[model samples]
Target: MIQVENLHHRFLEIEYLRIGEGHTAIIGPNGSGKTTFLKLCAGIELPERGTVTISGKEPRAVNTGWVGEVPDNNLVFRTVADEVASALRFGRVRADEIKPAACAVLSEMGISHLSSRATHTLSGGEKVLVACAAALALPPEILILDETDTHLDRKAAENLETMIQRRPAPCVLQCTQDMDTASRADRVIYFEHGHPRYIGTPEETFSHLYNTEMYPSLWRIAGCI
Candidate 1:
């Protein structure tokens, strides 16, 4: 379980929030603190006030795998296979065992063909997939994505959506602009000016927003405009 109590940041504030298993998507307009919230949850950034915890531990203390908005930001190796295996190497796994481990991870993610490709040469969609593969190599208890769909094409986004739905992690969270993607999540949190304006199922959240002037683009996407 993940809990946030009296959380406060530069542009974010939450009196209390609880997240129990399953997938949750965070959505808001630009600079509404979507990425900031993910960073806080990923343990990359600490909240200046209140508390954020995962399974009784602080976020930074928990094992987390993150895929950021820019795929290149997550790459640490030249080849796809190398990047996938990098986590194991850092964990001090046996050199002989690393290659097989990386291969297995790629196969599990259904991207074995990318193992031989150069990380820098991969297309936008391929990079996202490779980055996801690398993050999952750790098999973290919680997975966080920060606007990973921003650069993906429709097909790539759908492929990513499928991968996310099948993820083995107990908790998965992502920030996105696509209402269609957000609608598929178990729950959606809509933010306004860095504050959580609403939290509920997609139907409930979007149905409310569709009638308001806050999310014009979302209404158009949902064909409610």
Candidate 2:
């Protein structure tokens, strides 16, 4: 669970909010404090005032994995396999165990074929997948996806979504512009300005946003939009 109380940051202000475990989607217009809230949750930025906690612990105290809008920015290794093993190496895992661990993680993510490829040789979508595999390799308790599908095509985006839904992490926070993807979440948070205007199941939240572009396409075909 993630708990926020009287949170205040550069562009975010929330008196209180609690998000339970499972996948939760964060959606809002551009510059609506969505990313700011994500950063706070990821422990990348401390709140100016108030508090944010995950499972009753500060986010910084928990192991967190993150992937952002730009995949290229996430890669710092020469090869995909090395990228996946980077976290393990940083954590001082046995040198001999690195390759097998990296291989296993890549296989689990269905990207074993790309393991030997150079990071610079990968396509944008491939880079995102490699980055995602790297983040998942160390098994974080908190996994954050910050518009990671922004650059993916339909097929790649769907593939990424499948990976997200099947994630090993108990808590997943995804901030995305894709309403279809947002609608698939267990919970939907609708943010406006710097506040979460609505937070509930997708059915409940989308009802409040019926006339808006935020309405999911699935609902549109079903006439809920």
Candidate 3:
């Protein structure tokens, strides 16, 4: 289990709150420190105080795979195939194994055709798929998804959900404004002013916060407003 102990992060005089994890969903209004908290968990930034542990090991010390907010930021190679292959290469897998591995990953994401295309030329949604494929190729103990659903259309989102469900990991931490995604989570953490105001099942958390039921349609309504 991923455990966060007395975690505290501060920027100048402002303090971003602390939290623990167990199949968590970090939800909050804008500027509630959700992104910052995810960044700390991904070890992209260090917290000022306290500690974050992935299965009893520090995040940096562990082989934690992170898919950042911007998919393009994660791409180092020119082609999508190269980008996905790079992950396997990092693990010292042989050349013959790379194509099959990359093919499987891309096919799972339903983007196999684009594998030969230049990563920089793909659309935002396409880039997210490439980034996700690369992340899955490495299979980390902990997977952190940062607002990946935001760029996806309905069909793409469903495909993404399917892929996420199939990939089993010890810990899955997703930060999203999509209530559809939030409702699927095992537990949800609602943030207000950079602190967890509510932590429970999605139904319980949303019921207390909105004084209404939690449903996929509710998210649609929220999106319209």
Candidate 4:
């Protein structure tokens, strides 16, 4: 399990508050420190105070994998197949086993046909799928996704939902603007002014946030309210 203790981060006037785990969704308006919080949780950025412990170990200790908000940020290999296979290499899997492992991941993600395609040529949605597949191939103890659903279409989004449902991680933190995604989370966290204003089931959090003026107007515009 992931445990966050008295976490406090600030950049000028912005601050990030403490948070815990269990398939949590972090929802907030832009500039509410959502991405910064994710970066801190993923250990890309250190907390100025407090501690974030994943499985009793720091995030940096586990070779933890992350799927960033921008798909291109995760891209290193030229081909879709190569990108998926990179995770296997990171795990020290043999060269001959890489192809089958990559193929399996691509198939599982419903992108087997695009295995040979260049990563840069794939559409935004396809790249997101590829990045997710890469992150899941090795099955990290914690999976942190930042705004990954924005590029996905309805079908791809459904596929991603299915994939996440089957994830084995005890801690999954997804930062997303999509209510459909948040609605499925075990817990929903609302961040306002860099602090958690609400934390509970999707229905509870959404209902509470909807009635308040602090809720994002886009959620109402999208009919999620």
**Best candidate, lDDT:** 2
lDDT of every predicted structure (CA atoms): 0.83, 0.88, 0.77, 0.80
- Candidates in order, TM-scores: namely 0.88, 0.93, 0.88, 0.87
> For candidate 3, lDDT tens digit of each residue in 63-180?
6767778877878899999999998998788989988988998999999999889988999999988888888886777778888888889899889778776766567788888876
Which pairs clash in model 4? none
Superposed on all Cα atoms, the candidates' RMSDs to the truth, in angstroms, are 2.8, 1.6, 3.9, 3.3
Q: Specify the highest-TM-score model's number.
A: 2
Off by over 4 Å in 3: 11-23, 212-225
Residue 159, model 4: Cα distance from true site in angstroms: 0.7
lDDT of 4 at 9: 77
In candidate 3, residue 181 scores what lDDT?
78
- Please give the distance, in angstroms, between residue 105's alpha carbon in candidate 2 and its true position after superposition: 2.3
Candidate 2's error at 183, in angstroms? Answer: 0.9
Candidate 1 per-residue lDDT, tens place, 31-126, comes to 888899889999899999989999989998887889998877878799999899988787688999989988987876678988989999988767
| Candidate 4 per-residue lDDT over residues 46-129, each given as its tens digit | 878888777678878865668898878888999998898899899898989888888887887889999999999989899999
Worst 10 residues of 4 by lDDT: 11-20
Clashes of each: 0, 0, 0, 0
